[model samples]
Target: MSPEPYLGDTTRTPIRHHILSVLVENKPGVLARIAGLFARRGFNIYSLAVAPAESHARFSRVTIVVDAESAPLEQIVGQLDKLVNVVAITDLAPRDALERELLIASVPVDDDNRLTVLDTITHGGASIVDVGATSVTVMLAGTPDACDELERSLEKFSDVELHRTGRVALPRLG
Candidate 1:
């Protein structure tokens, strides 16, 4: 028999993003087990972030951005629910959630473009984090779309090194 098609095959299903906020006991190997499940099942995880959820360090919140085309949302959630450490899972729909990502970029600059680069960065609502002899580094914490636009704008500068933290989200209250 032919191998099963990749769950997120573009031709089979249109791509969509689903953000899942998972709460789990803060224990070793829990993250590894979750990642192993995705690897074994061929699910596509677009982005993931994990951090302590409480000061007591008893639980962690894992934010996962999944490729909706990879598998049925219900199926994915059901599989995650079977994990022993997973305490709860909440799907944060775009409209019902608030999401943010952090972007840091270092762009080469010179006498001719330093002012212009600063202008662009400030105008984009990013703050200058560092200034070196030949480059300037900027930081922006914003919605994914805003970060995308800023990244595109920086492409005009050659040798720009950009890093972005994957999205972290929470459901909106009220």
Candidate 2:
């Protein structure tokens, strides 16, 4: 289904999370302007990811996940559209998009439980990216649910550090 346009009345819609994919000029200050707009309007951003778009040097795509309950989605999109550097904006429906996040975690591994730790990583479909004397860094790139499962499994071990990329998504092709 196509997304409702920002010009329409959207306040009647139930409050929930929304993901906005915005394409903007790849120049300094664009990110700040978009972020400032949200901040000035008191919109709470859940997660944001930005990168150059499809190898293009002049454009970048920003994926922003926000709680629509904080503010009307139309208002937020309208304000974003008004920005000078913003080229386009698309609201990505969760069901119609492919979303993924990258997780990196450091788990302590020793002679006693080294095999167990590797087993956990293997079962979770993650890869051991680095190996240290006492710790191994594992990397997992998968859906949020998969990442959560991996995190829970890793908790069984001694966790030294963990980090995850917020999220990035694209609409699925027919």
Candidate 3:
């Protein structure tokens, strides 16, 4: 018998291509249970973000990115909906959606590289959100690959940090 395919990508290409949005009641243990389920199921959640909702709803919007084919992804989606606290499950990547982005990076800079660093920021649609004598943290919002591009462009200057909010789309009408 052959071993099962690994998570994320079977070969080099990521198999599960999905961005799942889960609405859940904000309370202790709820998040853990949900996460535990994924862990046990061997889902490679590449990215996830959770925060409370507005209107005192005490709900959290969890964006999950996973790699698998359609049929497998459907099973995962169905199982996710069965969880007790899950309120809604939306495939935001297929549909359109809105997302919030937060970034925190610590970058080292010296006189020799400061200009280069500044140039990278300008090109990345980001600015220095925080500054210190030897380091700076640049912040930006957009696609994950955009942020990766910025990091790649600046790789020569010094060490860098990157965080991606992943790709999110909302219906054009909205």
Best by TM-score: 1
**Each model's TM-score?**
0.87, 0.85, 0.78
**lDDT per residue, candidate 2, 30-146, as tens digits?**
999989999999998988999999989999999998888899989999999999899999997666666777889999888999889988888887888888999999888777667
**Candidate 3 residue spans exceeding 4 A from truth:** 1-15, 94-100, 163-174
Error of 1 at 83 (Å): 0.9
Give candidate 3's error at residue 136 in angstroms. Answer: 1.7
lDDT of 3 at 43: 72
Give candidate 2's TM-score. 0.85
Residues 1-174, model 3: lDDT tens digits: 212111121122233456787889998898887889888887767677776755656788777776655347877888889898999887855324343344446779888878877877777666677898889987766445445556577667646766666544333355
lDDT (Cα, tens digit) per residue for candidate 1, span 38-114: 88878889989999996859999999988878888888899999999999999976666677778899999999988
Give the higher-TM-score candidate: 1 or 3: 1
Clashes of 2: 0
> Considering only N, C-alpha and C atoms within 3 Å, which residue pairs clash in candidate 2?
none
Candidate 1 runs further than 4 Å off = 1-15
